[model samples]
Target: MHLSLGFSPCPNDTFIFDAMVNNKIDTKGLTFDTQLEDVETLNRWALEGKLPITKLSFAVYLKVKEQYDLLNSGSALGRGCGPLLIAKRDIPRDEIKDLTIAIPGENTTANLLFSIAFPEAKKKKIMVFSDIENAVLNGEADAGVIIHENRFTYQLKGLVKLMDMGEFWEETTGSPIPLGGIFIRKDVPADVRAKVDTLIHESLQHAYRHYPQLSDYVKSHAQEMDEQVMRQHIDLYVNDFSLDLGTEGKAAVTSLMEAAQKLRN
Candidate 1:
């Protein structure tokens, strides 16, 4: 059976998915028609139930849990790897609420975490994650929340970190930040979902076996990203949690969902 899959083109994603999508691993008779998009686009598509399987921010998943079932594998959940709130110059934390900030997307985990950190910061500009650094530097936004490969490159661009959102989450909740996960539409057969989950796990294992060597697939879609930064992106986002959410991972996700709900209330 052919299933549609959607995930970001970031190095970590491309690295995890390259093996399965490239036919490097046996998909157990399942074939994937993949769509490579940014996380925000994937998040919006999830709202419409646009794919059989897709990667979306945990924030968006809470809004669509009824339409999809979270897969145990292929998740981007880990500690010390959270979105960074950055600015071109020093900005007092007390001043954050009054500044116009740039976010990658309203539905992104970065935006969700930012909301939790500063609920009073109501002025926000949504833009592609890659463009946020420039937005701050040009004074279009006083501060920006950045994720993905941007976390590795921001300081190089002379951006200063105002807060490490992941650190705040860990310090407060005592859990790893549940950034994003791969989910399958609930309508997909249970057996198929299970098979897809296993395939994803195996795919990552295959990538790990060849560890520290960047694949052409990962590098190709990384655009102009430096190879070193691309590796950092993978190291930070993909981990044991990517193979399986496990107990701690699931608890972290639950904590994130509960936090989001409290904000909604």
Candidate 2:
């Protein structure tokens, strides 16, 4: 069966999905008609339940939980690998409430974490993840929450780190930061979902064993990123958690959902 899959064009995602979509491994008769978008766009797609399989921010998953089931594989969850809040210059953390912030998306886990960290931050402008660094440098936004390769390049762009939201989450909850995960439509057959999960796990394992196979694919999607930066991005985001979200990872995702519910209440 053919299924529609949506994911970010970031290195980690392309690395995880390259083998499966390119037919490097057996997909159990399943073919993915894939769409690569930024994390925020994928979050918006999740809200509409548009794709049968897609990557979504863990926070966005909570809002559309009834429409999608979180798959155990292809997740970006680990320590020292969360979104960073950056500013053109160091701003007092306490003063962030009055400053307008640039977020990747309203539903992104970055924004959700920012909210949990600073509920007083009511002034926000949503921009594409890649545009946020420039937005801050150009004074379009006072601060920005950046994910993916931005964490590595922000300093070069003269951005100062205001906070590491992932570290804050770990310090508070004692669990790995739950960033994003692959989700499947709940309406798909249980067996098909299982196949997809297994296929994704296999794809990740294949990529790890043969990392060179995905290098080309990763570079093609990454913009203005050198080979080293792209490799760094993949290494940081993909790991044992990407292959399968075990006990700690699952608990982290559950915690995020529960916390989001409290925010709503």
Candidate 3:
């Protein structure tokens, strides 16, 4: 049976989900959807069980845990690769208040981080991650918190990166932030899923051997994204951290989830 898997178009997945691009891209008797979406869209599918295989945020999984089972936990967004806060070069951090801040997805990991860092920033709001640059360039927002491709594309439009949240998270937490993970439907055959998991694990190992080729992979999948941006995306989310999803990855997810849980309590 063909297994349908999905992943975002961001740089991190080149190491995890591709099938035909490399024999190394394992499907475990499954096939890939390669569906490019933000974490939010992916989560929606996971919730509905429409995603037999999907990349979803742990937070989203917590919301829809009843409907899914974890095949793996780890996203390309490392805890250290926090989102970028952008403003015009003229704006200073202390002066950032009373300014409209653009956010991407409501459920995105980055916006969650922003909330933790600035719980008192009463004036912030969200725009699509895709809309951030134009919003700032058009003055719709004083600053935009950019994620995903915008991290690389924003500078071209005169938006100044005011903060690197990924770096901030690393300095603050000493752990990689849990981003998203590969999930299989709750009812997927466990035996097949294990094979799938093994395939993904092995393929990632194969991909690691070709680390020098990652830039090329990132450019192909991520739309000519620069080497530095791609590397930052990888460094923040991948590396040894990618292979193991480590104790740190689990702890990071648990911490963030527990903190989010407090809002309900």
Candidate 4:
């Protein structure tokens, strides 16, 4: 059977899915028609129920939980791995609300976390995740909430972090930051979902077994990212949580969802 799958072109995602989608591991008669896009695009697609399986921000998951069930594997959750609020120069926390901040996406977990942090920060401009850092530097925005690989390179670009949203979340909730996860449509057969879940686990293990060696698949989609940055991206976003959102992982995700709901209310 074939299923439509959506995920980002980020190293962490490509690293986890390389084997399963490339047939390096046994898929148990399952084949995936992959759609590689940014997490925000995937999130929008998830809202539309456009793919049978896709990776989406945990913030987006809150809105589409009724239509999708998160798969056990292929999640991006870990401590010290949350989005960063960055600016070209030092910015006072008290002044955050008054600044025009650039956000990756309105539905992104980055924006959600930022909103939770600065509920009064009403001035926000939405842009692609990859462009946020540049936007801040170019004066298009006073600051920006950056995610994915940007966390590693922002400092080098002379951008100072106004806040680490992940750190704030950890301090406030005492849980790992839930970034993104693989979600399967609830309409998929239960048995098939289980198989897909197991296949994803196997796929991640396959990638892990070949660790320290960057695969062409991962490198190809990373655009012009340096090898070190790519490795940092994978190391930060992919971990035990990616293999499965075990108890602690699930709790973190639940905390994030609950927090988002409260913010909404």
> Among these predicted structures, which one has the highest lDDT?
1
C-alpha TM-scores of all predictions: 0.99, 0.97, 0.83, 0.99
- Report the number of backbone clashes for model 3: 7
Q: What RMSD, rounded to one decimal, does every model reach?
A: 0.7, 1.1, 3.0, 0.7
Q: Write the per-residue lDDT of candidate 3 for residues 1-265, one digit (tens) a residue.
A: 6667777777777655543334555454555555667777786677677767777766575676777766653355364456888986767666666677888766667777776666656576676678888888888888878876676677788778887866776777776666677777877788877776677777676766777567354578776566777766665566655565666666877777776676536
lDDT of every predicted structure (CA atoms)? 0.94, 0.91, 0.68, 0.93
Over 4 Å off, model 3: 19-22, 25-28, 77-79, 89-98, 122-125, 153-156, 214-219, 226-232
Q: Model 1 over residues 189-223: C-alpha lDDT tens digits? A: 99999999999999999999998998999999987
Tens digit of per-residue lDDT, candidate 2, span 1-265:
9999999888999999989999989999999899998878888877888999999999887688899999999999999998999998888989999999999999999999999999999999999898999999999999999998999999998789999999999899888999999999999999999999999999888888987444677788986898889889988999999988999889999998888888888
Candidate 4 regions with alpha-carbon error over 4 angstroms: none
Candidate numbers sorted by lDDT from highest down: 1, 4, 2, 3
TM-score of 4: 0.99
Better of 1 and 3 by lDDT: 1
Residues 178-255 of candidate 4: C-alpha lDDT, one tens digit per residue: 989999999999999999999999999999999989999999998789999999899999999999999999999999
Q: Quote the lDDT for 86 in model 3.
A: 91
Name the candidate, 2 or 3, with the larger TM-score value.
Answer: 2
Output the better candidate (1/2) by TM-score: 1
Model 4 whole-model lDDT (C-alpha atoms): 0.93
